[model samples]
Target: MGERPEGPGQGGAEDGTAWSGRAGAQAFAAVDAATDRLLGYPFVFRELSRRIGAGEVLVDYGCGPGKVADEAARRLGARVLGVDTSPEMLALARGSATAVAEYHLVENGRASGLADGCADAVMCNHVLASLPAEEAVLEVFTEIRRLLRPDAPFVLLSTDPACSGTEYASLRIGDPGEVYGPGDELTVRLRRTDGSWQEARNHAWPVGVLPALLERAGFRDVVQHRPTVEEALTVADAGFATGRAWSAERARPPLVITTALATPAPLT
Candidate 1:
């Protein structure tokens, strides 16, 4: 992928930098509520939850607020570690996650302070777009590769080309930000609760091109999820239709990506 959109703590959202102090709080409340409903899809957790061994330590990569981590902890019986960049988001995540998860706030999404080969699994849900540079996403990928056991899995779900501008329009939610190539990054500007705009550049990738990236990241048994907007809508309420229209566009269905077993390949 090209460069990612800006990340949580970087760019215009610098420390001591406030987007919409009260605005972020309110919006995240709604975001967390919506995420609760969205996690119900079978494609969300069935395989990872069912397949991994009991008591495995899984990293909920880019765990914005640990919603998916909470789900994984609830069903898989696996211990979860939720990671993200926004302290406010992390604090909220700490509150929402079950006691089963070990919560943490990373200074950057590209780095999780865990030791090498420690994690059994890593999941990045809509996290790619959280950072503006492809380097950031790639760095996060490299970190996941480093921390997970050689044979572990790293599941990544990112924006499908058709739906990238639209689904992300939530932060902007409706605005079609600039589109660059896979290797490019998009810095998005959106309104916080207070009616002001903040920018975070996250990386977007076409659903079709994830495999090559995964391969380079040292992941195997890589899988891709190309759910149609109609299917995604069935899983969500009418309220999310606008939130997810990018998936509905034909010729480029925004996919829900899933990768497995981060088993390391031999060095060439």
Candidate 2:
């Protein structure tokens, strides 16, 4: 399991967990997150925008340094709450001029100080990769469910582990033909804004198994969508959509967005 909730490399035994200290936090804040920027987060915001309107509460679970949360707040006008297990990350997040409405710490496997069912919607982006077991993932889903009101939407943004070896703009998941089962370790390479690559050790959770897990965690209506470049042409920024050849991504889109609704609470 990952030491703290944030993006990959928050700290672990794999190679070197570079996402520590002020420098590491700054470096993480600077990651290009190319695949995410193009195909991952835009789709998440779109999904949230459809479900909730401006001023509603959106909890960004495992929000690393508040970049994506800030964007969601700015784009959708939601009161974004960023929660992470890492105090360092939360500090970095709070330091951002464009930080979200609030930053909260997650302690002892829960988002401390945030009330139950406080969110209108919740989005967990790439945080599951750090989990190494079904129970861990289920725990995350359960917590997310606890954060939502009855029937609130939970949008999970993840990378498809099967799309390995293919180099998209900024990410390469694993070795070619390397089929990864749930909880299998894999090396993911991410590009920085300055054009350098960094490796992170993460675990795989295939899209097929997520629905069942969500069901077991008190969620319903699980639907998964893989965003493609063709779709991005409509949803993404004009310049970004037409920016690159995006040949690899066009052929095999690695990003997956799983949307589910929290089941209503049982009667007392």
Candidate 3:
């Protein structure tokens, strides 16, 4: 995921900047909704809801249009705080507000204004890869740790660096004209429902590198999840049945879902 631009209606990066790009925002907003229905939202949300539980405070870092936050609030009975850098995106999120979810704007590269230890669980969905630098990603992780109580969960979802743009089950890379090398920043074009195209920029980080970064950010017991065909079939909605078949033959997973525990404080 890349940062959104500061100007109005321009899609830029997700590094705590406003996504003012109308087309980008609109495309992503649609993607956010489709993700809930077509992708693995039911499974992911179920896992998150179980881990975070009802009555827990969940901080959705880079919440975009607040789709996940709203869903968590409605389905799992959790209180969700959605933080994003894009005012345009936040505007959309606020427009669809539910009683259990709130939206806030955050500064680029910082999670300031949020109180320490205010969250029981932190989830960064497709947001970490948007960070241009490793330091920025680390800062976000550190901030997540700051916002969480000891041993709280930090869940992350990102594009699998191991899988090529053409290899994913549901996602298709279109008109990019080039393959991304390791750790390269690349622009991805996604086809929209109306036969239009939307673009997003992402950094390619290998799966092996993420756990070390989490550990350095003071998280422990890192675990990775690669949903299998059986798992996908069980949790996927009818609309995503074809995607499960596509995933069955793939050698690498399409998405990387990782979880880590915030390390406990040492007793004085």
User: Could you give candidate 2's per-residue lDDT for residues 95-130 as a string of tens digits?
Assistant: 882748998888877988888889999988988888
- By lDDT, the better pick of 1 and 3 is 3
RMSD of each: 5.7, 2.8, 4.6
- Which candidate has the top score in TM-score? 2
Each model's C-alpha lDDT? Answer: 0.55, 0.81, 0.62
The candidate that achieves the highest lDDT relative to the unseen native structure: 2
- Each prediction's TM-score versus the true structure: 0.69, 0.93, 0.81
Can you tell me which runs of candidate 2 are displaced by over 4 Å? 1-15, 97-99, 266-268
**lDDT minimum window of 10 residues, candidate 1:** 1-10
The window of 10 residues in a row where model 2 has the poorest summed lDDT is 1-10
Q: Write the per-residue lDDT of candidate 1 for residues 3-73, one digit (tens) a residue.
A: 11223323224221322243443343333223223332334555566557778997776565455677778
Query: lDDT-based ranking, best first?
Result: 2, 3, 1
Error of 2 at 89 (Å): 0.7
What is the TM-score of candidate 2?
Answer: 0.93
